[model samples]
Target: MSLLEVRGVTKEFVTRGEGAMARKSVFTAVDKVSFEVALGETLSIVGESGSGKSTTARIAARLLDPIGGSVVFDGQDVTRARGKDLARFRNNVQVVFQDPFSSLNPRYTVERIVTAPLTYQGITPKGGRQAYAQELMERVGLNPDHCRRYPAQFSGGQAQRIGIARALAVNPKLVICDEAVSALDVSIQAQVLELLMRLQRESGFSYVFIAHDLAVVRQISQRVAVMNRGRIVELGTRDQVFGAPRDEYTKTLLAAVPRINPEWDAKRRQKEAT
Candidate 1:
């Protein structure tokens, strides 16, 4: 039994007609997606844009109601949960959005941003909100003194750290990172990845790491699911999928990794070594 299980989940959106000629049609966003994330393990969904990876993530996190299938989190069916149940489900399964700037409120201070989830969940820690928020800030690589500053005051990476702190405020078991570090520079991306790895180790949290970058997903995921055109075409351990992908699409993606520093000697050496 995994901590999270998505069984045959499907989502479809009816694209409305526009103007006089635009016709109405249903767009299948996710199709029969089934997978599981064990406690303390990361499951990466890798795909290009418009691949329905984000849609699957949203369905799994209960942000969107699926048209079919089930999302069982910690043995509770989240697809049908409502009211207090929905709130609790949200607390347990938090999300860190791709854009750090847009995720945090520009007007609210960092401390307030982190503490908002706690108040929403009705959790008042023994040391109170201030102490708890400070602890969370430090945990996410932010200084407690900067808690008074607004989102605009921080760098892109720092704003993301604030987002991470906010996600952890409720002691969530699962974190759905929808392209979490994709918007940052290379150096900041590495730093944020390291921080996420550390958080998972300390909190025993599972991550649904969704990204188009195979390299990024490879760095953190234990298991990988390759999605295409609203369907999961391949699913396996990281080594299995990345090293010996059975699907032609997966192999094509692997083959497309850019080689900016191409060299005959290096190419030969790499091939021979492999």
Candidate 2:
């Protein structure tokens, strides 16, 4: 069974009324989008800005309710889940935001930041929170001794590692990465992505990775879904999307990639010559 299913979801925002300027138009941010993610797999939602990629992630994470359609998790209808059920749903699906600096608490120590999720979930690990937090730190490539250090003391990569550690604190079954590594340097991004993959393998967690960079998504995702103007235009395996694009938009996007790769350059030159 699929781990998550977003069935024909639509999200619309209504313009607010103002003095002598009342407006009632609906801005369709997301339109009739549907997809599924299986357990222990990574599915990437790829799109440029304003393509509703983040909106889809928000819906899956239960941060926003869709105007039309349902969100199901692990065969349960989470679209209408309430109270403890809603809380449980939220706990099971965690998010790692785009900017680690903005996401992490400025004053809290790494220990507190990572352990906060466990405490908030009312989940006491086999050992104490401190022990769990330390283990998490070590797992994410941060020194356990640095748990007491504040976010200000950590670099961007380290801060993001802390964010990953915090997200794992609740033992989430699925993680929604909303451009989680977009702001990091290339090397740091690679390191963090590797860490995320490692953690997922060890913990058997699923991922809905949302990003604009197709190259980065190709590195970690088994399948890719392309969203354009509030709808998914194409969905396929990484090789299918990158190598055998079936949609014109997908082909155009692929054509725009820099011809720095030798094989790609040779193929393009051949095409041009022909």
Candidate 3:
């Protein structure tokens, strides 16, 4: 079953020109975009910068209210959910932002940060917040004892793990990762991606992964959506999109992805073996 569905969603921003009497114009960030994320599936939206992938992520998370279209989560319309309804929607869906440090509160200890979602939901964990937070820390491969430390004490990858732990605190049905590992080093990105896949296998929660890197999208997504100029140019399964692209934009994007020289890689591997 589809866990989250976004239909004909449109978002626009009104901007004014340089002078006081300058005219105002509307810039559409997202235009009639639609997609579905199935239960226990990873659906990635891939595009270059300013392609509205992040905007679509925010819309799916309900951080932005679209001027048009509807957002349905687990069969309930949540485009305009307010108060308790919104809170309930938040509990089921969590977001892991692009930057870990910026998303976390520096002043707060790791424990507080991880458990903040529960606190907001007014749902006290059975074993108390500290125990729950520590459990989450350990689950995400972080040291449970370091729960008392601040965000500044952790490395970039570690901090992102803390963010992941926070997202899992609510036992969300879907997790929206908005360029979640793009800021990390390539090796660290691989580690984080592995962790995410492992967690999904264990928890059976879906993922709406938004990224610009086609390589990263290939690793995690079962399905792919290519967006350009605020619209989805192509949507298909991983193999269909990567192996036989139908859209010109999609083909261009695929061609742009950097690939290592196979012959050079083989020679290096042989040398290492000797």
RMSD per model, one decimal:
4.2, 5.1, 4.2
What Cα-based lDDT does every candidate model obtain?
0.91, 0.89, 0.96
Against the correct fold, how does model 3 do in TM-score? 0.94
Report the C-alpha lDDT of model 1 over 44-120, residue by residue, as the tens digit: 99999999999999999888999899999998888899999999899999999999999898989888999999889
- lDDT for model 1: 0.91
> Which candidate leads in lDDT?
3
What candidate 2 gets wrong by more than 4 Å, as runs, is: 16-24, 259-274
Please give each candidate's TM-score. 0.93, 0.91, 0.94
In terms of TM-score, which candidate is strongest? Answer: 3
Q: Please identify which of the two predictions, 2 or 3, would achieve the higher TM-score against the true structure.
A: 3
Provide the global lDDT of candidate 2 against the true structure.
Answer: 0.89
Q: What is the Å distance of residue 120 in model 1 from its true position?
A: 0.7
The window of 10 residues in a row where model 3 has the poorest summed lDDT is 264-273
